[model samples]
Target chain A: MIQRKKSLQCRHVDAGSCNACEQELTALLSKELDIQHYGIDIVASPRHADALLVTGPVTDTMQPALKKVWEAVPKPRQLIAVGDCAAGCGVFQKAYASHGGVDKVLEKPDQTILGCPPDPEKILDTLRELMNS
Target chain B: MSEASRVENPYNEWINDNISHKKAGDVWLALTGYRDGQIKSHWLRANGRIDEVKTACMDAQFASLTPSLPEVAWDEREIHDLFGYHPKGHPDLRPLVRTPRWPASFYPMQKQSDDHIEWTDVEPDNPAKVVEGEGITIMKVGPTHAGIIESGHFVFSIIGENILHLDAHLFQNHRGVEKALESLSVQEAKPLISRICGADTVSHQYNFLSAVEQLAGRKVPEMIEWQRIILLESERILSHLNDLAQIPAGVGFTVAHQRGLAMKEMWQKGLSAIFGHRFLFDAMYQEKLAVSKKEQLQQLLASFITQWHKWRKLADRQQGFHDRMRGVGVVKRDDAEQLGAVGVALRAAGVSVDVRTLMPLYRHNRIHIPQVTGGDVEARFQVRLQEVEHSIALIRNALEHLQGNQQDTSWSIPDDLTGEAVSYSESPHGLNAHVMQIQNGVILRYHVKSGAYRNWPVLAFAVAGNAVADFPLINKSFELCYSCADR
Candidate 1:
């Protein structure tokens, strides 16, 4: 059965990223790839969000903050990891302050997009897939 | 202890004299030591650009340089934070990167302390201080903001719509990157360094590789040097486009913002199709396959250039846009210099200090540097536009050279190299520097002083007296990185 999907109201959490993921994510809202036109938009608050778009290796200092953001989102919300750093710590694996990745602090992510910073097209495609499923 | 007496600390005395003579930019502190004895500190003084170094040993404590040079305060605090070196006379000795969450006595980078031990959270000290005045209100924003950007906290002391003062507290994104590199080899540490600031990866990687190459007395092929320049210029174009979009967005000019965004998307798409990563992060790590789509990339850029010119012309003619940006968030020339502003902030303030032009390394040393004296948001925006034009010319020149010849792509670093070296590159944001002390090819201590680190304080200066609503326009004009600053 196809999932009854319409629009996704996403809230992005930067657990401990290097700002690369933020740049590409910002590009998704640009004119060329208007993810909003595809019924996908990044909302301001977690309460209004249907999914959480997370980035970074979940630094120790940010772990609690990340969890709080997760709790703020309503039930049945999806968690999508957006970069190599979010999936498995990437280059900051052994960092003293980092808690490895998003999964280390939270449960397993529903979707993972991999790259140093995954391209906006790939991000858009993944979001489209997530919405359909 | 008199100025004339060359007593116990001769190096400190010389630094005092040189700073008194009004040559602050030329004065630098070089602290060197290997896992032993009192660290040898040197005052690297430059007289009319002629460099000289004088060494001195610490006697348990030293007079801080920040008393004379206000710009040196942050570096002094960083020194205190990292090596546990106390700066006796410096003001605001509060920890910068190491927040109050750690145990009171622990210094992560100091020798003999095992930094890998589990950290326990302590109550964080109030990040913002209360400003008492008639009708004064204080507001705190972020570590998590409404926008899709990195984390930073801004404390604004306001009266009605005007901002009386602003303080920025960063380091929310700090992940001990420098500490993480300590146990890794030079080859192993390259990946971590490149990601220091995602937009400026090419420049950061270049600085690290160049530092290692210098330490090992090795040289990259001339063609490879030219290739590095092309990549740097390409990255600059993409980053400038992002900054350019913010100016229009700040003023509610959606058409101009969208137009700039479209060009930026095309530029990234061209790079991705040719190089395989939109931001070209992969290209920095390995050799590219070949320039199979040279014509296609060229056509894409050519169209982008045409579109950019059209949009810029339209935006420039808009009276409302000019009125909004013309005099907003002005950083005077003196304030920019005193606060150690770099890149767009410095250049827009009419200060001619660029790392590429100052220390020429690339094949194309004749790159045009833009300067606008207004020191406002419009000045910064103008600087970005002119720089885009210059980068386009640079990329074309490098591409023309690339079409003529192909070079072998194989390189390696030897296992054992022991030396301390510093290298810098002109990143899109500003000068990105990497100083590494290597002991037997493994990093002993690695310090990254990014452009964001120097420029974050300057933003606080720019926002003062401006209306609260104009803060975003002013802040976006600088376009600094929180992670780079925090690291």
Candidate 2:
């Protein structure tokens, strides 16, 4: 794992998720979780992101866009795949329109969090580990 | 024309004319309509019913229904793009699901086209139609927006601060879910259906399962029916709360936005504790709800209602929040009905067209259909607020019925299940319908027409004549899901 500073600025890319992952990711911003308190923030632009948080099965239409976003992220960036779909396409495997996961389109993800949609706590835990790394 | 079969119209009061054409084995083009509290589905082939026309032949040409129905315009365009069917005289027949990256010769929905093919990086030519004038300035926004939202392209023709016309381009995230479902078994397709849109999981799963149950000729017990109602209402409350929070966020009302999100978090956590998943992914198949868990749910809801009323009172006091939302993004009743608006949007426009009214499950209960006249952002907001309260009542009533019932919720699928059926469920967004064909327990064809698909065009209609700066606010008010539409 690449060592990161005290703060982790992540950019989320919805490559073709069903939005379940996005829902959980949004939940991370809730007052109960408040992922920002852990020194993790979801940045608006990929340029300022220390990590690229991806979700989805990486459909053919989104493959190029995902690559572009990954390239736009600065060096020493960690690529984190959230949800089973991003890790290995889950139910969408062998889909004609999908590349079947983020790894098939981009380089291997630095970390993969598993679940149909990993719970907010699980995602926050991974982010915290990245922060401490 | 003489060979076309005309089935008996059980709903003659609503459907006066019914026409259908057989387009190969077991597949036919049919029409569905609603009138006078009755929804009629005219099945032309076997036992299958389709809300709109379904032409399955390769390179088939059919008369465009958009000129008459107007609601099926998007359905036709989608049929053309995915199924290689040509709708003659269809207005604005641009690509609906297929983006520019997809090859023109390739139609993904065709059975023969199922094999994997190399995708080309070359951008294909597909242009947006915009109004041209001497001083008109066109503004284009996202297939990828600045916020944490789904992909949708909006082309606006603006003069000064007012929007003249808005052309929305969506389906950039189409993952061929319908095509993918074809190869899976009936039971295997549940996971994909549940994920069609995470927030609408229970609604989608319910619709799909209803269709499957109909195919198998299985009747769910009364206790299980009550369980289903509880699950559906819980999902409705969650969805409404999220939208309630989002609308305020659109208007920059931080207090209500944050408070609403917090309330929503509490509800999600409560659901997670009771049901395994936060979004209730496969909660439909859950066997039983213990009495203790039910009590815990009631306690959570009681506190939530208290918090909700306090937040509403505080938010209503803010005149600025109301000012930004009152007259903005007004969708008239005539336009809403003509364009086939559903869920809160339709009800807000004073149209009583909820699918739940047609279902026996809700009809057995005192389901309230909330209506407002303005059809603006504030009207939609008010409708959603009313619905959250109604949903809570619905859950409580279902729980009351389930107080002593401890029956197994699981139902077995028949081994010889084979047929096609159409089922509709009132998803939080609106009416979600699924048409599925099963051949000996395997899914042959599956088509989903979500409320988002029907309401997307209406959203574009709502945005016109509004100030350019208020676009986000208007968009948030509708809060349609792009993932479901794309799928």
Leading candidate by lDDT: 2
Model 2 score (lDDT): 0.78
Residue B241 accuracy (lDDT) in model 1: 93
TM-score of chain B of each: 0.90, 0.89
The residue pairs in collision within model 1 are none
How do the residues B1-487 of candidate 2 rate in per-residue lDDT, one tens digit apiece? 2223114322222222322222222222223211111122333233333434323222366555565456777877887787677766588798877777786678876655466675778642248879899899999876655556776678999999999999888877788888888857867888888888987889888988888888877777777788889889999999988999999989788889889989898888888888877898888876576344788888888988898899889888998888889999999998987787888899999987666766766767867888688999999999998899898988888778776666654568776678878877789999887777778888777778788888999999999999999888888898898888888
- Top candidate on TM-score is 1
Over the stretch B30-90, how does candidate 1's per-residue lDDT look in tens digits? 3333233234333322331323332333654556667666776777676676567776678
lDDT score for residue B58 of model 1: 63
True interface contacts reproduced, per candidate: 0.61, 0.63
Q: Per-residue lDDT for A56-117 in model 1, tens only?
A: 88876666667888999997889999999999858886676677888888989999999889
The lDDT for every candidate, in the order shown, is 0.77, 0.78
DockQ of 2: 0.63
- State the DockQ of every prediction: 0.63, 0.63
Q: Which window of ten consecutive residues has the lowest lDDT sum in model 2 chain A?
A: A1-10
Q: Is the docking of candidate 1 incorrect, acceptable, medium or high quality?
A: medium
